[model samples]
Target chain A: MVKVTYVAHDGTRTELEGDPGDSVMSLAIANGLDGIVGECGGSMMCATCHCYVDDDWQAATGARMDGEEDMLESAVCEVTGRSRLSCQITLSEALDGLVVHLPEEQV
Target chain B: MSAGRVVIIGAGQGGLQAAMSLRQEGHSGPITLIGGEPGLPYQRPALSKAFLKTGEADKLALRPESFFATKDITLRTGEWVDAIDREAGVVRVGAEALPFDHLILATGTRNLRPAIPGIDRALDLRTLDDAAALRAALDRPRKVAVIGGGFIGLEFAAVAAGLGHEVSVAEAAPRLMARAVSPEMSRRFRELHEALGTALHLANGVTEVTETGLTLADGTEIAGDLVLLAAGVRPNTELAEAAGLEIANGIAVDAELRTRDPRIFALGDCAAFPEPGSGRRIRLESVQAATDHARAIARTIGTGTATPYAAVPWFWSDQSNLKLQIAGLADPTDDSVTLEDGAVLRFRDGRLTAVETINNAKIHMKARRLLAAAPVPTRDSLLQRNYDLTAA
Candidate 1:
C-alpha cells in the first residue's frame, strides 16, 4: 500500500492508503475527500481533479501526462507550475508518502 | 426560513447530487431521495463504454451505502412514486404518503420504443441492469446489430467490435450523431468506426426486428444474433402532467427550474428550462447538465438564492481510441468551420455556438471558457485570431 497525504486549501491534511495501481484522484474520491471531483471518472477528460504537488514530493510525483496541461485550461482555479491533474498521477510503491495540496475549488 | 423536509424524486445523478448539494450548503433539513431503480445510485455514461468491456459493476456506484447513513439521508431504492399530491404536499408511494415541505421532480428519461414490429426483441441499454444483461449476452461470439448511430449505439459498436463481435450499426439519419455533433465530427467518427471494422448503414431505418435480425425500410435484411436498441430516450413526465404541472417538451420550468407551484421544482432530463442567452426552452440529458442543474437547484433551496442555471453545456463520447468532446450547444443550421488542427467551430448568426474536438482537450476547454464570457467570440474574431481559442 502507498500512503498519500491530501492537504486542503485551508491547510487541512488527510492521509490515506491505496494500492499501487490506483490513481491518487480515485483514492481521494473513494475516501470521500471533498477536494477532488474527478467528474469524468479518471478519463482525463474533465479537469475537476486538479491538484498542486507539494514541493518536497514534486520529484517523486514526476511530470504531467501528454494532454494534462490542455485539460487544466478547463479547471475553475488558477493553473500554476505546480498544478497537476490528480487523475493522471498513478500511485506506485516508489513514492509512498506522496503529499499533495488541493485547490480552493473544483467545479 | 425553516429547515423543512426536502423530498427529491429520482435517484439518478441529478437527484443524488441534489441531496448531496443541499447537505453541502449546510441545509439541516431532513432529506429523502427516492429512486425507481434498485441499489445505490450509479452513473450511466460508462454503461455503454467501459462497463460493457470490463463488467466492473462495483466501480459504477456514485457513493457507498454508508454515505446515506453518514450524511443523514433517507435513500429509498427499488421504489416507484405513484403520484404527486400538490394540494396536501405529499407523494404517494405504495400504501404510504410521504410529505414534503419542498418537492423536487428529478424523474429522468426512458428509452423510446418505436412502433416497428417485433421491437420487443431488441434489448435496451438504459440502466445498469440493462447493461448487465447486454454484457451477459456478449459473453459468446455472436453477430451484434445496433440500431441508431448516436453516442450510445456507436460507443457500444466500438466496444463490441473490439471484442471480436461482428458489429453493424444502422442509423436512420444521413450521418452519425447528427443531433449532437457537427457534420465534420460525424464524418470523422464514421471513418473511425469503419477503421475499427464495424459496418455502418446510414439513412436506413429499421422497419421490423425480425427473428433473424432487422429488416431495413428499403426491404434489405441484416442478419444478427444479438440486437441492441440505442435509438433514443423520452423524458418521463407522466407523473408531473397528472399532477397538473405545466408540461412542454418536458416539465416547463423557469430560469430557477421551478414549476408554476412555488413549492415544486423539476430538473435534469425531465425539465425544460430557458436557455442562458437564447432564452429558448431546451432539455439536455448529459451528466454535466444534470449535476450542474442539481447544484443550482440546491442553492435556491439551501441559501434562498434563485440563481439562474447558466453553466456552459459540455458532452463527450469515447469510441475506438477517439475522444470526441463538445463544449457548447449548437442548432441544426449552425455553420461549422474545421480548423487546421481538426477542431470544428460552430457559428450561428456570426457568434460562436459550439466547439467540437477529437482528442484535443486544450481547444475544447478553452472554447468552454470563451463561450461563457459576456461577449462570445464571433466568427470573424476567430478568423482574425487564426482560429486560436487561447487568444479568442
Candidate 2:
C-alpha cells in the first residue's frame, strides 16, 4: 500500500492508503475526498482533477506529459509550476508518502 | 404521491445518468434502463481515445454491475427497444412490453455513412467492438485512411500516427472540424496533424472505399490497408419519430426537456432543445450536455421543480499532445478574435458565444463561468480588456 497525503486548499491534510496502479484521482474518489471531481473518470479529457504536488515531491512525481500539461492549463484554480492533474499520476510503492495539494475548485 | 415508474431507452451516458440522477433526486420509483448494447453502459468518448491505446474495455464502464442491483435499478442489456406504445404507456422490446409512467429517450446517435460505393468495406470507431477491431488492425504497421477530419477521425488519426502507422485524413469540408471550431483553430490543428506526419486532405470527399483503400471525389486514389469511417453521426430519432414525437433534426424538447407527450422526455444527442438566450433549437453531442440535461429532467420528475435547463455547454478533443477545449457554443459564422495567449474568443452580435483554447484549462473554465453569468460579458468589453476574460 502507498500512503498519499491530500492537502486541501484550507490547509487540511488527509492521509489515505491506496493500492499500486490506482490513480490519485481514483483514490480520492474512492475515499470520498472532497474537492476532486473526476468527471471524466481519469480519461484526461477533463481537467477536473487538478492538484498541486508538494515542492519537495516534485522530482519524485516526474514530468507532466504534453497531454497533461495542456489539461492543467484549463484547471479552474491557479496553475503554477507545481500544478498537475491527479488523474495522470498513478500511485506506486515509490510514491509512498507523496503529498499533493488540492485546488479550491475543479469545475 | 408515489414516484412514478421511470423508463429510459438507450443506456448510454445520458440514459444511465437519468436513472442515477432520478434516485439521487430522491425518486423512489421503479427505474428500468434498457440498452440495445450488451453489458453495462461505458464511456463512449474513450472508444476513440484511451481504448485505442490500451484496448481495455473494462475500464470504460461507468458503473459496476452490482451498482445497478444495489440501487434497485433494473438494467436490461442486449435488448433493443422496438417501439413505444404511447396509448398503453409501454415500450416494446420484441414481444416484451414494459410499462412506464414516465419515459426518457436517450437513444443517442449512430455513425453517419456517406453514400459512397463500397463504403461497407470501411470499419467504424463508434462502439467497443469497433475499437477492439481498430486496435487489432493497429497491431501491424500499415497505412490507415480516415474518412472524416472530425474529432473522432482526428483522434484516431493521431493515435494511429503516434503508433508509427501512416495516416491520411480525408475531410469533405474545406477546413477541419468545420462545424464545431473556428477557422483559425482548425488551421492550428491541421498544422499539428501535419507535424505529426499525418496527411490532411481537406475538401476531399470519399467517392469509393475499395478493398485496399479509398477513391476521392476528384479521382484521387489513396492507398491504405484499413479505412476508418468517422465522418459524423445521425441522431437515433427513428424511435421518437415513430412514436409521433416532434422531430426537428432530433426529437424536439421544450426548455424543461419535456416532449410534446407530457409523460415522455428526450435529452442528449437525440434531443433538439432550445439554446439558452438564442432560443434557436440546437442538438449538442457532448457528455456534459447529456449529464446536465439528465439532472434537470430528474429534478423535474423527482422534486416537481421544472427549472429550465440552462447549463453552459462545453466540449474537448484530444489529438496527439494537443488538447482543444471549447466552452459554450459558437455558430459557424461567429466572428472570432485571437487573444495574445493563443485562445480564440468567438462573438455573435457583440455577445460572447464561445472561447476556444488549446491546452488552456484555466481560460476554458473561466469562459464557462463567464458565459453562465447573469449579465454575460460583451464582445466589445472583452476587446477593450484585450481578451482578458478576468477583466471583463
Per-residue CA lDDT of candidate 1, range B113-165, in tens?
Answer: 99999999999999999999999999999899999999999999999999999
Candidate 1 Cα deviation (angstroms), residue B334: 1.0
The models' CA-based lDDT, in order, is 0.91, 0.89
| lDDT of residue B241 for candidate 1 | 98
Question: What is the C-alpha DockQ of each candidate?
Answer: 0.55, 0.20
Across all models, the iRMS values in order are 1.5, 4.7
Question: What residue pairs are clashing in model 1?
Answer: none
Winning candidate number (DockQ): 1
Q: Chain B, model 2, TM-score against the native? A: 0.99
Candidate with maximal TM-score:
1
DockQ of 2: 0.20
